[model samples]
Target: MNAAPPRVLTVAGSDSGGGAGIQADLKSMLANGVHGMSVLTAITAQNSLGVQGAWELPEEQVVAQFRSVVDDIGVDAVKTGMLASASMVRVVASLLRTLPADVPVVIDPVAVSKHGDKLLGADAMDAVRSEIVPLATVLTPNLTELGPVAGVELRGVDDRELAAKILLDAGASWVLVKGGHDEGPLSVDVLHGPGVREEFSSPRVDNRHTHGTGCTLASAIASYLARGYDVPAAVGAAKDYISGAVAAGFALGGGIGPVDHAWQFRDISHPGHPGRSKQE
Candidate 1:
């Protein structure tokens, strides 16, 4: 048999809609050529319209899942999203502390859903600041999330840079301030780290089915990192992947749809599936 692929673990909730959360993360990992594992923290009754209901898993169960995965399979990289409560945040932070120092951890502070439903509790923000931020190899926060986590109102690029600095000083190795929510022609993501700052800009795709963009981006970064790409390179590659996924997004339900995680394979034919044809 051949050697196993790079391993990536996602500690997050489950999206019943199969748009964001663990579903998106695993798809991204597979697309990036990594073995994806999951430790589910919560489950949401969600769809293209919105999140209807959410239930957090027991804290002990969450811990047990993490231990089982890390102790046996082991992880080359980890990405976190949609931790439901303060207690959950604390539990995940403690679990992360047990990992080997070399493993990269991408933290996507998922506080709200694409449809404006709350995922993380308001009470959990403090725990995220005190416990989770420090352990991040790369903290991925969008404009709305950045405001609360960094305690600043993001008005422009300058504000975003300052907020990123605040996160960098808060013990995160790097902070990616995403500009997808901003009203602009280009979707620019700013990466700020120890003596390193770079802007990665891509033309904003005109698609509206961007339900899982954050989860996809962060998971792709972890997948690339597991495959041995450095931080900046991993993020750049992830941006490219997300851009294509967004462009190829399709309508799934009555409301907004999801990005196509398999966008790169649109033109490729599998054993049982035929490739797309030209205009009929």
Candidate 2:
């Protein structure tokens, strides 16, 4: 019998498009070498264009799914995406509190979709700040979400660290402020934590089909953490993985598509592919 691999759990919604929710998380975990499990919190009628409709699952169902996984299979790390309601956030946060203190929790503070669709319900941000943020081992929030989640309006790159500090003081052990939305030729992300502040930058891809980047990055971080990398190393590795995925993003429906979660496999199979190194 084969030994089990590192297990990472994703507590998130299901995207019918399979681009950016639990679907993306599982794909990223697989690419990063971990066994991924999920506790579905809601269902969305989503596609490459945008989310058409969404409905949060019952609270009991969410709790049951979580307990079924953590109590039996166990988890080395966890990643959270869209908890559609404030109640859902508290439920998941309460469940997370039951895990061993050592298990890393990567929180992707998702409030809006790539195509400008709102995902969180009223007062959900409050629940996230008061309950979830404090439990986070690493909080991954995009440029837009940073200010709102931390309750501050950022002026520019200069204020990113300040916003991150607010969340850090709120109790997240580490905070990664993503710069994917910044206007420039480079995509920059800042990871700040205890005695450490590091910047990761990659050339912005020219592709418009760059959906699922957040879910993928957060899951990749959790996967690496589950495989035993320290917080800094795990985040760095995730950045590299996401960079490749973003570069390989392809179009799906009429609107934006998704990042290639299997880009590493494609690189392995086709070493001579343009833009990818033979030794990658």
Candidate 3:
């Protein structure tokens, strides 16, 4: 058992463009040396530009998929992305409650896409805030998301802790207030746990090819947790991975691109020629 790789499960939507959502989550898990599983909540016709269309799966279908995995393969950690509606959110929350207490859970609380497309239904917001969020071991929300859920205007990095507190109050064991939306020299994330607070900072990569940063980061955190990192450690590791991915991001479509999930191997293996293929 010790020789096997950690297993991570992601409950989220599918990005047909293969840039974000479940696609990004699985890529992050693999990049971080973990096996990935998924229970799709919805499917979206998305590209680097934004989501064009989406449809949520039936609650029964979601439940069945979840059961198939947990009943057989099991998971070391779980991360959730887009739960399209209120009903889906409730079902997921209930399912997580049935899992073993030890397996950590990271909730990304995805509401909007990188291009500002609304991925979560307006009605589902309440269920996610109350029912689903409380079940999370760690709630990771970017500034755009934090502003609404925490109800505090985040002017800059200074107010991150306050936002984290608001999320913690809602029942998550810990809160990671993502500072990606802040205008700063560094991309910072504040991880606040019970009596524990820490900040993770990295050089904000200057790149427009950052389509799936949020989804990638949250799943990366869960991957680290599955590999046995404590909250702070997991977050730090995930930040580093995301930062590198961002730096390596390249144009994939007419619009924004996705972070390079395999950069660690690709860059290291081809040190002299980064972002170049044999044809180049």
| Pick by lDDT: 1 or 3, better one | 1
Which regions of candidate 1 fall more than 4 Å away from where they truly are? 268-280
**Stretch of 10 with least lDDT, candidate 2:** 269-278
TM-score-best of 2 and 3: 2
Between candidates 1 and 3, the TM-score winner? 1
Pairs that collide, model 3: none
User: What are the RMSDs of all candidates, in order?
Assistant: 3.0, 1.9, 3.1
Error of 3 at 261 (Å): 0.3
- Give the C-alpha miss distance for residue 56 in model 2, angstroms: 0.3
lDDT of 2 by residue, 1-280 (tens): 9999999999999999989999999999999999999999999999998999999999999999999999999999999999978899999999999999999999999999999999998689989999999999999999989998998988877788899999999999999989999888899999999988999999887889889999999999999999999999999999999998988888899999999898877745453232565456
The TM-score-based order of candidates, best leading, equals 2, 1, 3
> 160 in model 2: Cα distance from truth in Å?
1.6
Residue-pair clashes per candidate:
0, 0, 0
Overall lDDT per candidate, in order of appearance: 0.92, 0.93, 0.88
